[model samples]
Target: DAGVTQSPTHLIKTRGQQVTLRCSPISGHKSVSWYQQVLGQGPQFIFQYYEKEERGRGNFPDRFSARQFPNYSSELNVNALLLGDSALYLCASSPLGGTRTGELFFGEGSRLTVL
Candidate 1:
């Protein structure tokens, strides 16, 4: 029973670049969520998906997108990176369909540094 896992634990990029972060949920979990955590702030919800269909999204701009695979793994892609986009991108998996479930298992996160 592994916990959620995310790749490229940390990375650096310049403005205008694009980045993709990957995640794998804990075994048997069907829901995955993406969150952005800025320094001194709690994680902000970005996207949620269940069974490979998008179920929810936050107030982020069109630059942010995500998709969940048939196996329940997910990817978060940020286009035209801005300095404001630099943050710890967290991936959480739950047994239920949404974040309200309070049953989330989170990965350590992929830290992005935009310059």
Candidate 2:
């Protein structure tokens, strides 16, 4: 019955370091997506996985990657991080094949600060 869960609520890293954020989808959900939200701006979609397969990807650079497990949990990895990459990493989950209502449930998100 949980909505969604993300780990390491916060993180701080230096430029060029790599980081990985994790997420667990809601019960009965089979699709998970990642987003990046910079302060004062709307979230930007990063990646989406359904049934453990990559369904979609946004305009992010090659440094961003993600994968979904069989259990519907997912992880977002960023390589060669830059200060520009500092932002809130959000995880969202929806029903498999999506919902007609076009609603997505999101988690508290992981805040990453790159220096």
lDDT of all predictions: 0.94, 0.91
Mark the 10 consecutive residues where model 2 has the least summed lDDT. Answer: 95-104
| lDDT measured at residue 88 in model 1 versus the true structure, 0 to 100 | 98
For lDDT, the strongest prediction is 1
TM-score of 1: 0.96
- Give a tens-digit lDDT track for model 1, residues 8-78: 89999999999999999999999999999999999999999999999999999999999998899999999
| Model 1, runs deviating above 4 Å | none
Off by over 4 Å in 2: 98-101
Please write out the lDDT profile of model 2 over residues 24-57, one tens digit for every residue: 9999888998999999999999988989998889
User: With candidate 1 superimposed using the best TM-score fit, by how many Å does residue 84's alpha carbon deviate from the native?
Assistant: 0.6
